[model samples]
Target: MLSKQLTTCLAVGVGILGLGFARSNVAVAQEKVTLVERFDAANPYRVELKVRLSGRLAVAFEKGKPPEVLPFSGSSTLVYDEKVLPADEPRTAKAIRVYRETEFARTIDGKEQKADIRPAVRRMVVLRSERGKKVPFSPDGPLTWSEIDLIRTDLFSLALVTGLLPAKPVSPGDKWNASPNAVGDLTDFDPIEEGGLVVEFLSVVTLNNKKYAKLQISGTVKGVTDDGPSRQQLSGTAYFDLEANRLTYLNLKGVHELLGPDGKTTGRVDGTFVMTRGPASRGDGLTPTDLQGIALSPTPENSLLLYDNPDFGVKFLHPRRWRVGTVQGKQLTIEESGGGGILLTAESNSTLPTPEQYLTESRAYLAKQKWTVNGSDQPRRISDTPDRVDRFAIDAEVDKQHVQMEYAVVAQAVGGATIAARLPWAEREELRKDVDRIIKSLQIIKRIEK
Candidate 1:
């Protein structure tokens, strides 16, 4: 989901010092170097960061290595104004302000310096009416063509956080393409006119033995299309972690498109994102409640659920849906449409198996239940590797419900768990089509700290 809360900070700074000591007893030779000269030698540092998002943006910075945690903080604001000119009426304008904040530590000569820098009331963009007095602009209509172009430009550059601080220079159409499928047709799209872009550097910080650069940016839209003339605004900040080799944070806010005829506003999108630098750790011993911050509950309509919990190693999705009715809890009473149903339960005792082993055991277990196997065969591997997909099939009777099931089991290596979702017999025809979507949406959220 696009984040509603827009809070992010990026800071980058450098410090240099030179010291010389003379021998006490005899004449000594010493070289003198100024701090400014040392600082100038380290002036420009290369920075590259990638920010990923599932719900919120995860900022990962690359500075030739993993980023160091830097102490930092700051704030910034961007103001946008739109002026509408009517041939017969007086000129009128409206304005709005977008705010941001950042904080971090600065690194200098093997030492860290604490700093806070905030940029306030920076003008991002100014929109002007195209028709002037000749055409009457409606104050409450859809945005003009110019306005849409303006908003698009802002969205394109707002990912660079430092551009919003001190107003850095930006070339027109300087764009970074996300994944081709993710960004889709939006490739090569530009929001502002050529040569109208600007960027700002806000703050610098050092953390965890790493350095970071914070930046902010803005730009105006030039009349490129014949559709009409309009104005736009774009602003945001980015944190480049020099040590960790990743982008740690990024926040962007801007009018995506113009709404009304007077170019007031049609729609808007603003959000902030934070990302870790490397692969996430596996929490094998943690409980679901510990990791997810909430207990799992079952409902009557879909009471029973099954999931692979990497932390607990073994657990049921909805235990309440299956009540122990026999010795050793082998027999379970499940609520059914007719009244109730009985089913046997068993669990694996060894560490979670690979996808192949898990699927093989599940099939064998189903066979032991005496369920009729209408058809059984191994399916093609879903992944590029041959050992990734393990398939199984079962056609049987569970109470009155005639069940046909099949599944392709795959292990989430990074998540440190194996996952299996049963495919209903009726939906088997379309199972292959929908399976990828389900797999893509699977997530392992980190447990929140208490």
Candidate 2:
């Protein structure tokens, strides 16, 4: 009887100990972990961003009328060799991105346009803010409007990716909200009026023998773009590489709606994006030496954008305030937002027009439109070489308001180009500065013979 009692007691003690060991194991598995970004200035990163958006434009809904919509789709793939460096005291860092490839295409109503930026011209210095990232022009030249659009597409930013991580350690199933800047950048909404991204720590998974923390994100945002008011519903996943201590991969899909001035929905888009960032490889060519002697900041002259039109064989530089409006046939139009206007016409001829002859033609055309010549009618020679370019300006009156007009006739072997600009007389000095820059930099490579 004594032996039997001793055996039973030992068995019970062993069972209790086994239960305690199991409980301890569970606790260890549930421990929290801190996920943070570790960016070293000495190391460069290669980032690949790909996006595809498809939706409808001109969504019209009227009483007793079927909804009408036009199909639209666009895609862009961009690869960048980026270096994250320290920035101003308050801001964390800025990135100098050298774009290796930028390919974009868009189709609306069965019309498609595609462009691939040349390798030599793909570079910019990025400055981050709560609003968004700003790409200051290089000392060489500014990016064209279309190029800027592709570069600034709605995708993950370094700050946005970092902001999604919890400030404190988070265990599995823990949830938190992302910062406003992150939400705004992801949604392409400025001045976010409502809603934010909710992030949840899903679990840790192993990939390629490395542990990664998976996160789930979902949210809705309402705000405005420069065009109009907008709303977005975003849902995505991000992977935090525990070994690397960085957010290396992200995938997001969302629906975007554009609203009119009256708060009515005008358009809608369904889009998805995937971004991956990793250390630059050996042959990536983003070494510190490659960036040596390269200007990392923008000056006024370098900030000017290069506008190249191979069809007309005309190339020039213009400021950011000016935008290319339309190009049709042999004519091109550039306009400022609610301000000045410029028009250019290309004509093929056996002879180039003289400065005096061009001026006579310009005055005659304006006179036919009831514009009274307000100032001197003589064509003032802007360039000493009238044989190359006959450029001049005139002041006129129409609709009881003073108007200033500048004209340039670029002379070539067998063809010529004409530039005409009209703006308010009071704002001539500032607007003229932009026109003068274009005139000085304009180059005619080849002429289309009529």
- Local distance difference test scores for all models: 0.31, 0.73
Best by lDDT: 2
- Kindly list the per-residue Cα lDDT of model 2 for residues 37-102, writing each as its tens digit: 866668767677778999997644677664567899999888776777667536544677677667
Off by over 4 Å in 1: 1-356, 385-392, 395-397, 430-433, 443-450
RMSD of 2: 11.3
TM-score on alpha carbons, each prediction: 0.23, 0.81
Candidate 2 lands at a TM-score of 0.81
Among all windows of 10 consecutive residues in model 2, the one with the lowest summed lDDT is: 1-10
Q: Can you write out model 1's per-residue Cα lDDT over 1-450, one digit (the tens) per residue?
A: 112111112222111101211223112113211111011111111112222211111122675553333322222222221111112223422111121222334332235444322232111122222221111111222222222332332222212222222222222223322222111112122233332444444434444344445444444333322223333344544544434433445443433332334555322223232221211122221223322432112123222223333342322332232232333332222232222332322223234355556557767776887665555555546664422434454455544456555454443332223443334455545543333333333333322111
Q: What is the Cα-based TM-score of model 1?
A: 0.23
The worst-scoring run of ten residues by lDDT in candidate 1 lies at: 33-42
